[model samples]
Target: MKRRAFFLKAGLAGLVVGNQGLTSCAPGPKLYGDKNFYINKGYQAIPKLKLSKDRIIKETVGLRPFRESGPRVEKEMLNNKTIVHNYGHGGSGWSLSWGTGNQARNLVKTTDAKKVALLGCGTVGIATATLLQESGYDVTIYAKDVPPNVTSNLATGTWSPSSRVCAEEKATPEIKANWEDACRFSFRRMQMSLGLNDIIDWGDEYTVRKQKPSGSNISGGHEMFHIDGLNPEWKTLAQKDHPFKADYVRRRSNMIFNIPSYLNFHLNNFLIRGGKLVIKDIKSLEDIDALSEKVVVNCMGLGAKAIFNDEELYPISGQLSCLVPQTEINYKLATDGAYFITRKDGIYLGGSGIERSWDTTPNRQLTEKWVDVLSDLMKDMKG
Candidate 1:
């Protein structure tokens, strides 16, 4: 089948596409008590996102490993081998990789083994292995798949530490405290990696709303465990200060990752540091026992649901429709249940969280919905 026909048949024809310029909408008349009056200083015009089916490069699906009680960072003994559990970060796997890696490293410190085997090569596994290597442990990563194929590659690549990390009722005081530590540590680590081959950097994100926000907008039970400073505060923009057509526009600076570059950099770094990567499928505990290393850190993400029999672990499926990279559209935008983030590889449009879903198949209807939402917003912007 032809690429264009395939996309059109998959419902890409619903997308509104054109050269829509992002001129600012006219501001309301100034009033003495009005705080939303147009301001010129610090105002920057946003460029229109040229969203089209023709620009779409690919669509991907990822199953986020969600556990009701939050991530498992504890340790246990399996077949006399030290097994440190470090999986289940839900949608925040990439965002909280380093912090969880630190927790896993601490667990390994209790063991006498200098060589460690890491299961899975996703964000968590790679991050944990890299930390272990830096801490003087010879590490070998065993995984069924690597980057560009792993679940982490399908991530939106935004820094959202608490998104679907745990259920609100399960977020006990102890969990909140531990999560705060992880979030803070991870945020610092992400900031430290800025400007290194453009793997990570800060980008402005705008959240447009048709009505004024009356309460917290944080979703996926994140508001209960919101970490101050680590979670950047959103500043509500005045009508004339932004280009969005919505009544309420809020902006915040957040860390964004170029997944391909970021993963490649870490993977290459691990290889250079004498880290071994074995392509192996671990089906059961006995498979891990067959390894030479006595200490194993399980960073299998959703795979832990079967291997470790974690009843609380399940999948929260998400999908991303990637378009050709737009150099002018550097900033991210979120509105009407859809978001757009421009990375070096592509401009990713995504926003779907279906809990308890193990299906990794990309939904054409959902893809069309996202494109419709984003293209509608773009078309409303003045030319």
Candidate 2:
């Protein structure tokens, strides 16, 4: 819509005043399927303005950066080279990049080396190099794209790291522990970056539920989330002030990151910290190991499958359509298969449960379909 309709569909705007005072036209998110889904809590909630206008201007989509199981946070090699692999963070990389990097850096704790070579310039690489520099090690980042162009910038990142973790991730107790630690550590770290707009801040994200949602709607499958109890760094909505009891809502001051802003922050500060970026393509593990100096962290995201030959590290394939920005609202909403939110640039919307859909190409028709569903949802929102 004008950005208002977009933000409303994205759960950024709450119930509005209509011909009747607080009647059937109160703002709420659309419900597609019947399930126990929570409000997305990704948008900045907006109250109905008595003396102003509303807007909904943009639409966008992004992949969840899927990888099987927990991110690869170990050290391995090909041709006897020390390769500290650190990629495979399906959708939670932006939220947990530095925490995982901290874990990856710990692997090289006893090494007396003062310089480290890192592969990839995405969030993982940048975070790893940043941590290394903090630890007195000179780090050089190697990759094809840096910052704004990297997959990291494509993310509508927040504090919940394991939001899209694969079903197979909860297998081992130790691995589960690692997952929990990463989630907790990451959430805490994000809170620390609040002073700067680039890295992190507390924004409102709302999720609206329908009485009975259907296919292509919110799945409500995440009834029970297991982790180190790392709830989004936001506040939870209480029942007394809730909009719809049939569709429960929660609010919080969770971490909401503006990708471009933070990516620029990293790019501007990397070299000042003595961090170097080497732009090149590494076809094989040998190329990566040969390029770096002492230690190597592989935050390849989806690229891990090819570079490391990881058959399990497959793409979860997600798409988001972007539109203009609406600062009046700032929250994120997640339903069955669709999610909506307003960031710095455009209002973000998503709906994709197609397992193994390799069609990375952004189809304009598919985007319109997703947007249509969102609009239909608004038409069907409850009081």
Candidate 3:
């Protein structure tokens, strides 16, 4: 698990020569012996992160709302109200917010209601509200918690569209098409927001390895590149040019979010657009019926599990630990299960995705375990 298991879980390792002989295991490959790969031979090594327990200013957990058939973006009738379910995005919520928000807006347009009610003020909720408001609908967001306090604030904030969104077995052709639409829209929207300072920025991330990656992508999910309009700027870095843990490296462009700043920007935009937020904990469908608006957009994240009684909805609980800011590094790294992204707020590091865990409080043991693993990883990296 020290390396092989980590890479496998991260979907970075392509395949392995086990008893089965060259069976595929993961999606990415850093297969060695390629001298023509593009890497900055003089690349400066990323400084080791301060991962001590005390360096963790705050520890937060998020329940990534996951459904086997992708997110529930359909509409239904509940107590004379048109309910648009927009939850269950799993780990792709932040990444797909705008696109799914667009879908929810389109659904809302079909309804006669002008005053739209958005449930759950997480990333999805705020994004939906903004879109609806801009579309000339009066929108209100009701939730027990708001951003910086919600699960969206705890996101790793990387623009990855298909991370555990749906199992490959469940993704049909139609679903794949929907995924492509959502991913493209979301990615384009992010591109439009690129000049927003620390709120959203393009990042250069490295997926480093000691051995070259081999085989094709075995981890099945929607591939954005398959979508006609999308083109990725991924490059293969040769070992000589690679700086960290080198044998080979994969460099790609990632749309990163400074969670706090990004959340603030959205909240501020929603508010500026005449949006209203009411603190409410909706326990049942009956509670939804009590709302003033006839059309309700549900963006409740894991809260939908209880409200909608969606058996398919489950939590992939994730935890993140941060270190003090460092300006010497401007890039991010992904290896094993851990990923590191530097933000103006702090340098975020995390790698815990426990399925079906509802615990929100930080686990000291798990936090230390992630820090230790990352610390060891950094130590093992070559200059």
Per-model TM-score, in order, reads 0.87, 0.76, 0.83
Q: What lDDT does candidate 3 reach at residue 357?
A: 86
Deviation from native of the Cα of residue 79 in model 3, angstroms? 2.5
User: Whose TM-score is higher: candidate 1's or candidate 3's?
Assistant: 1
Misplaced by over 4 Å in model 1 are 1-43, 213-215, 218-224
Looking at candidate 3, the ten consecutive residues that score lowest on lDDT are 217-226
Candidate 2 per-residue C-alpha lDDT over 161-199 given as tens digits, one digit per residue, 9 for 90 to 100:
665655553546676678777767766766766778555
**Top-TM-score candidate index:** 1
lDDT by residue for model 1 (1-383), tens:
69978888666434432212222343644444322322223446466787777787899888999889999999998877999999899888888899999989998999899999999999888989999999999999999999888989989898888888889789899988888888888888888788899999788988887777565643322434676565678888887777667888888988889999999999999999899999998999889999999999999988888888899898988889998887867788888678888888999988888888878888878878888898888777643
* Candidate 1: C-alpha RMSD after superposition: 14.2
Using lDDT as the measure, the top candidate is 1
Better of 1 and 2 by lDDT: 1
Compared with the true structure, all predictions reach lDDT values of 0.84, 0.64, 0.77
Q: Which stretches of model 3 miss by more than 4 angstroms?
A: 1-54, 212-231, 380-383
